[model samples]
Target: MEKPQPVVVKVVTPEDREEAYRIRIEVFVTEQGYPEEGEIDHYDAVATHLILVFPTSDTPRRAYGTVRMVTLPDGTGKLGRLCVAAKLRGMGAGALLVRALEKEAKEMGLSAIVLSAQVHAKGFYEKLGYGFPDGGVEYMDDGAPHVKMAKTL
Candidate 1:
């Protein structure tokens, strides 16, 4: 059997931001029922965005995943808005996106990375070495339960 081709990940440029936004809209807004207006925020202007693309010979490269990272005032990296195209979930695209974001965080000299993970994906973040804070607190965001998870770089 042929191995699947690896997806390419890159820091978003002016041209690529739209693709990242599109994927986020599909996952967070249309599919997950997040508020359309709240799906975007001021952070988008200052954050560093990442995009994952699958290459093809017959058609344009397809954008399948996205995530954004922002350096917090306390000097850690905050990762958010991570999403993979529905058709590509469970195929390693999400992991690839997280790895890319972690590398970017390291390159930015961040001491740690933190994220508010949806409750359903807590195990997924745990597998990637992120863990909830001591005492295990949960909070609600946009009506969905979430936990704060972090990993030291």
Candidate 2:
């Protein structure tokens, strides 16, 4: 069995924002069937984006995962648009993205982080300390069942 490649997460620079967008397109738009136009939205203008990449010298730095955090009025960061390349699933890249986002949230002085997680991924979020809202309920989000989750920073 091959060991997973080491990955690093960095805040997406203005010039490299396309790298983040491309990863999101591959995961959400092309693979998950989200509308391409909707994949890039107004929130992107206000959110802080991060990208996961390999540091191998053999190839140019290419992003494999991406996530964003937007500070909300309630003093919480809204975590959204998380995606990892299909080929890299189960490589701990997703957890690293979430951990990096948590650090970003702390730097922004956010009280907590909130997200609407796909129902199937509830356990993933739970493992990262995200909990459902009191009396939480699942609802349709863009044709998929999702549940509200939050984690204190």
Candidate 3:
């Protein structure tokens, strides 16, 4: 058994946005059965997108995970559209993506960060210092069960 190499996560530039969307499409639309049209939305235009990439000698690097952060009107940061390539899910890529988003949120002077996490991933978010508001409640989003979680930055 061997440990997987760490990946570099960074804010996506104009040229890298496509790769971020690609990973989201693969994980959300194709794999999770989300509608193609709903996979992308207006938030993408204003949000700061982050992508996890494995360094390679290849000309164009591929993204293994992605997440986006948008500053709300109230000054809180919202994290959404988190996804990791199927093959890289258990390799800490998702956690790396989240930590990157948290760092970005703090840099922007946000008071807190929030996300609507899929039900199954609640524990994962909890481990990352996110918690449910008012004990715990579930809601439906994109036809999947999700819960709201927040962490102060």
Q: Between candidates 2 and 3, which one is better according to TM-score?
A: 3
* C-alpha local distance difference test of each model: 0.84, 0.85, 0.85
What global local distance difference test value does model 1 have?
0.84
- What TM-score against the true fold does each predicted structure earn? 0.91, 0.90, 0.92
Stretches of candidate 2 exceeding 4 Å from the true structure: 1-5, 57-60
Q: Please, what are the lDDT tens digits per residue for candidate 3 over residues 77-153?
A: 99999888888877788899899888888899899998898999999999999998757799998788899999998
Q: Give the winner by TM-score: 1 or 3.
A: 3
The true-structure Cα RMSD of candidate 2 reads 2.3
Backbone clash pairs for candidate 1 read none
Q: What's the distance in Å from true for residue 23, model 3?
A: 0.7
Model 3 reaches what TM-score against the true structure? Answer: 0.92
